[model samples]
Target: MTFEMILVIIVITLMLAGLFFEMARPDLLVFFTLFFFIMTDIVSTDEALVGFSNEGMLTVGLLFIVAGAFERSGLVERLVSSMLAKANTRQGAMFRLLVPISGFSDFLNNTPIVVTLTPIVRKWASENNISPFKFLLPLSYAAILGGTITLMGTSTNLVIHGLLLDFGEKGFNFFELAWVGVPITFIGLVYLIVVGHRFLPDHKSLIEKVREKNTKDYLSEIQPWNRQRFFSERCD
Candidate 1:
């Protein structure tokens, strides 16, 4: 093998090891690896910078801004809360939660959707006497499945679309991926609602544990003091 190929392999192995062990921040490790490659002439500076200018990368950045705005608008929370309002059973709640989450993920980036809903779902589970652990995994899975439904659903899809354009090929239509994504999403949600939740740990959330610990209460009394006397003493 060529020396450059051997060197590239070594660098990649080290980079993966650093990521696995969490030796540094992921972005830092990635940036350092890229810089190392450029310094060694493995990739030209222009080639390294090309990713920054890639249409897909730019679209992902814009989507992050839009996702942040959507989260702050409180629309998702309201919609989800209304859907889950009548869901008394675990199966019902799981069905209601996963359906909207998957649908929303088809348009907006799924990361923020998952992040914004996590606490809300946890609180709902606690209120309904269910474990948050059961819902969290399903929540993530639904988002992933939903993102597959459209080109804009996830960063990976958008990046691939952009790459296809760069290579002078026709890119994916908006709903092109939905043909496969819809069926997989349906099957996955069914499995979670019917059987997957049964295997999750039923551990209490940290907030519940803390609430239990602080259940006992004590009372204390304080005597009133003369304000004029206190001020006079301070002045003297």
Candidate 2:
């Protein structure tokens, strides 16, 4: 093999190893990898840095900011609260959670969609006595499915469109992928409701586990450190 090919293999191997070992953040690792490729002359400086100026990247960043604003406004919370009122069973809860998440993720970036929904889903599950494991993986999968529904759904689609533009090719139209996306999402959600539900774990969530431990180790009063006279008892 050529020296360049061998070096590429080594770099790829190291990146995989780093990721598998959880050595660092994935974004940090990717940045360093790109830097290394630049230094090795595998790609021109412009090519290596083009992503920084890519419209897709900027759009992804902006979408994340918008998602953050939407989150802070508590609109999503209100919507979730109203929808969750119908989630009385595990299957019902999963359906209620995944359907809306899928719909939003189809039009918005999946990363922010998942981020915005995760805590809400967790809280809803905890309050309803549902196992978090039953819905967390499904939530992730639904976001991915939703992203496939539209060009704007995920960064990868936009990134590919940007790359096509660089090559003097026409980019995909918005909703071009929806033809396939709609069916896939429909079938996937059906499978999750029917077959996947049987496989979801029933384990207690971490918060529930911690609460149980606290209850078991209950210590209402400490003998020596008691401050009942000064703190608890108040003068009339």
Candidate 3:
């Protein structure tokens, strides 16, 4: 195989591995397009750096900061807590939780959202006398599904946009992907509700709680659960 084809294979492997491992440093891969351009001499230095100058990048960053504010301002907590309180069953809570989280994690860091909410969700299940594992996998899966919904929704989406622009082509619109993504999201949610949940763990035990404090006078707590107590300590 040619060197170019080998490099493409390596990149695809790394992307999948990064996502699978939920690696913290995956952000470094965000600049691979720049490296590709430099190696291929696709454009002048100024043209190559234009992605950093685009309003799209700013918009994506602003969305994350806004989401962070939502977390720090008690908004996400209040919203999630409200939903959990009203949910009479674990399944019900999972259905409701999917909406915000799928959208939020698609844009922001999926890892943080997953980690932060896992304990809260476990507490909800504990309060309702249900299994947190029934929905934890679904939660992670839903975020992956929903992240494909918009151009600002995921790193791959942004990378695609930059690469398109680099080729002097039009980039994706905000919600164009959502055209197909929404249907996929709905289908995935249905799967979680129906046959798929049978594979979920039967019992989940609460080990500890997750607590958060921010300089902006924000504090939130999550009740932790352990299935295999050892697995909980990996903290990745």
Best by TM-score: 2
Can you give the lDDT of residue 44 in candidate 3?
64
Clash pairs (backbone) in predicted model 3: none
The ten-residue window of minimal lDDT in model 2 covers 227-236
Q: Which tens-of-lDDT digit does each residue in 27-138 have in candidate 3?
A: 6664664576577765468877776876556556666676666667776667788977787665677778887788776567454566567767777667666667887888
Tens digits of per-residue lDDT for model 1, 28-137:
99999999999999999999998997787888788778767766888766787889998878899889999888998899877777887898888877876678999999
Top model number, lDDT = 1
Counted clashes in each candidate structure: 0, 0, 0
Global lDDT of model 3? 0.71
Model 3, residue 107: what's the lDDT?
A: 61
Clashing pairs in 1: none
- Sort all candidates by TM-score, best to worst: 2, 1, 3
2 against 3, candidate with superior TM-score: 2
- List ranges where model 1 is wrong by over 4 Å: 127-129, 215-236
Task: Give the alpha-carbon lDDT of every model.
Answer: 0.89, 0.86, 0.71
